[model samples]
Target chain A: MNQDKMGKGEQSRARLLQAAAVQFAAVGYHRTRVSDIVRQAGLTQAAFYLYFPSKESLYQELMDGFFQKLWELSDAGGKVTPLARHEVRDRMKENLLELFRFFARMPEQTRIVLTGAEEREELHRKLTSIVSANLRKNQEAGHVRPELSVEVAAESMLAVVQRLTVRFLLSGERTAEQLAEDAAALLAKGILQADRTKEE
Target chain B: MNQDKMGKGEQSRARLLQAAAVQFAAVGYHRTRVSDIVRQAGLTQAAFYLYFPSKESLYQELMDGFFQKLWELSDAGGKVTPLARHEVRDRMKENLLELFRFFARMPEQTRIVLTGAEEREELHRKLTSIVSANLRKNQEAGHVRPELSVEVAAESMLAVVQRLTVRFLLSGERTAEQLAEDAAALLAKGILQADRTKEE
Candidate 1:
């Protein structure tokens, strides 16, 4: 949303949301009040209510937007036609890099949503469904192991992504590309050395 | 820990702690009151105080115990001498199964600790350190791949275990052995099909 191009009402609403994100990220959702948000946004209480019915609704909208953005990213990456095992691995790496970049771009919101228990659960559920569907497709294409449970695989992958994103990327300890490379390699071939690959 | 061996004072303390776990797990730590916990245990506030100073201390003790148990499990599993890749995989599976059984046996405490944001963060930190150290030793023993980051690998593995434990084992949708099998397979070989092994 371009501040200069937005209408007056839209501009006010955007300001309010931006302020709320900062406030929520700093003190959390429960401690943040409407008055504080409005004051930070340089808007009146009436103006805040004009854009959002209640503080709860505004917070919900913020979460909804964040989740929606992540869903779109997951869906977009899954749209690639079924590929070979190596190609799938590459695609996973690319997708993970993109995700890490998104987290870096929105560190505060990412931390807020990922650290909150309920919000994290909701995000995980959505990511699992999308990732599970993609894995099923890959399994059908014979890229993934047939015996693997897509549910477990998806959840596990998301868990790894979440952990790495928070500890490595968000904390500035490692680059997204570096984390993505290691994560993709780990998920593709795992931690075992070369010898075990022959047993299968 | 055995109720049959406990004296009167020990029994009272155990009841209070049990009551607190139920209350905290049911309604969360912030909403639960000391009065409610004592009442549920059929004890008075003074009795509760005799064992613990305040609600915060009691909650902290429960969290500490839960984390300590998990740390010990991870540490014990890491004690096996370096072995063949297959043997290591077997050990991983067995360790995961044992961890799952522990979660199943203490479902309430598991849920309480896993669901709480602060508790979950602290537990993740402890588990990651223990697992990371184990991975480092395995790497030194020529088991894990040389290129892999033990930090990433350990955190990823713990994330998968946590996800599977909460989603499948705690929900009773899968047995401990079943989840351990899938988890170990995923962590050992990942989801990729067999052909990619040659690329490495």
Candidate 2:
């Protein structure tokens, strides 16, 4: 109950979480055991239980934390439309850069998030719906293309972001800013030549 | 073996495969046991073993079959560059339609393919590299935009196709042809308005 004890408890919990993340990333969620986490953290089973009741709870906490951070980052960007096309693209690139940087800083967390765990489906659905809603708003405001299916476009865009994060950012092959810029370009103009389309 | 016995063996193997696919789809690959598959097929363990050495082998066979079918469908369309832009779009749409139809007919197989299993990483890598190589060739031929990173474009395109298939085609919300056309349009022109970009 004292301040020092509470601080120690918080430290212990953080250690356990870090250990769990490492183990989960190395051996995967299904194979990772609570014992391994405790051992890696240099804590006893009692200490782990005091913090997380089970390995599943620990994993859930990790996922929840990541999703929370992601939502906050995206929400901080506010509405995406009502700006010029280039301005909107710049905002998208900035938001994605922040997101990729967050993921890149924690490759273990990135792996777990991208692993398609059953628990992640709910979060994925929520994120997709949020994006769909945003796109719908933008379409109504005449910012996005009118012909595009909001739902399909949201899902596809999220998929592209996730895949790029895993392939490039996680591997440290490219910086978050560079990947974000490329992704924004692709999402904005696609892979087709601009002049060629006009000529056609 | 005699022709009659071989024919029966083939029939039994096909039955087991169907049953395994059903069970795996219902309960997922990790939870579905060899016993459950055999029971569903109304066959013996000996028979299942006579065809697939293990459950992993059966799952691998299923994946291989899907990949083979997909490759054949794409290859049948031939090279994409020789055709005009419209023709290329049609070819891409038609190929995607066939692929979507394949997934629609067997949603269970689609679930397995999209589940991101460890065994699937190799197949995914192979598919991405093939797409990247094709994109590189197109860029060289001045068909694709030279500014785009072939690797990133390939991965993003594949991700979009997969997400669309799972969300639309697999769910039966849209016909394969409709989804393919919309997907092709998005892939070709992207999600942005044409004149808006020029104006900006």
Candidate 3:
């Protein structure tokens, strides 16, 4: 595609994703129609198809962006000085803190990712991959337990983070700061991998 | 209600619940209509209202059954002995293993509980109460750390369990026995508790 067309495509797609996130989160995926998203984006209804072929695609894009940002946090930690294996968890904790802080501000994606859309096999599969990769990376760095399976560890830990974030959004009880702090503790202690016990 | 009528009512309700679970798991809460449930249950559609005012009520009843069984497990453990804290967890593990094994065999409620319905406000509230009560019981028994806020501990721990269970359901990778054992270790090690350095 030409650069101009590519740029336009990206812009419209971004607007649709942003609009979808709001509508889907507020009214839910089943309730949010193409017309609603177009109206929210202030774009033509047919134009949404120009960006996303369907609602599920739009949801995938939204999740793609959300996870891309989360993955970036882990990558950003690479710039920090390397600590010993145990000490490296502090860096991971910082990454978790940043991720939780970012999530608190965007409960729309947070809700869907944690609970709503995870029911969809496609979305759940994509999320599983994202989690598995991150866990492997942390394991490779020696910051996480090698004895534990990264795939299970990743899914397990993501479940904890996702659940806590959803509750934060739902109950309106926890502040972003509090969530970040709690997430830090969850990571530092390896809440999912504690005891390095047998996989269950 | 008369005994005969009550017995019939209970039988009808059980069948209704079974039909609802299958439909809800298959099509999801929003998509699964009450007509579909009654049809699946081989009953008149209007009769559903007699048992459940709404489809949501059926779901509520299902959840109530789940919570009641969990408490029963705790009660059984209480009858045995209190001196062996680890035994409580062991029996708890056995209870959960049976529960989750049944869960695995049953169609799919992991998603229904987390993401099936739109908003799931009432469901979350029920879950929160069940979790809160369980945490309080453990604290009173001195099995859980009294210093930690019951609300936070309960919700967080529930989140952890729910997340892992969903992952297990979606991935179909982890064995139930392994999950129960790992959870036992995690609980024993105080991973879900407030602090690691200090005694509970």
TM-score of chain B of each: 0.81, 0.77, 0.60
Say which docking band candidate 3 falls in: acceptable
Q: List clashing residue pairs in candidate 1.
A: none
In candidate 1, which residue ranges exceed 4 Å CA deviation? A1-16, A41-65, A190-200, B1-14, B43-67, B190-200
State what share of the real interface contacts each candidate retains: 0.85, 0.71, 0.33
DockQ of each: 0.54, 0.47, 0.33
lDDT (tens digit, per residue) of candidate 2 on A86-194: 4665677787788888988778887876764744677688888787888787777655677778788788878998899888887888889888877877886542113
Cα lDDT tens digits, model 1, B107-136, are 879888776554677677887888888878
lDDT of 3 by residue, B1-200 (tens): 34466677777777788888888777787798988988888888778988888888888877666656544543343432343454555565775576556556553455565555653576567666766676676667766555555565556556655666666654586777777665544433442334333432
Of 2 and 3, the candidate ahead on DockQ is 2
lDDT of 3 by residue, A1-200 (tens): 34465677677777788889988877778889999999998899779887778898888777777777866754544543345554555566666678777877677787665556534466556666766676666667655556666565555555666667777644588876676565555444543333233221
- For model 2, what is the error of residue B50's alpha carbon versus the real structure, in angstroms, after optimal superposition? 8.5
Pick out the ten consecutive residues of candidate 2 chain B with the lowest summed lDDT.
B191-200
Candidate 2 chain B TM? 0.77
What DockQ number belongs to candidate 1? Answer: 0.54
Most TM-score-accurate candidate: 1
Q: Candidate 2 clashing pairs?
A: none
* iRMSD for every model: 3.2, 3.1, 2.9
Candidate 2: list runs displaced more than 4 Å: A1-14, A28-31, A43-65, A75-78, A190-200, B1-14, B28-35, B42-65, B74-78, B116-118, B190-200
Best model per DockQ = 1
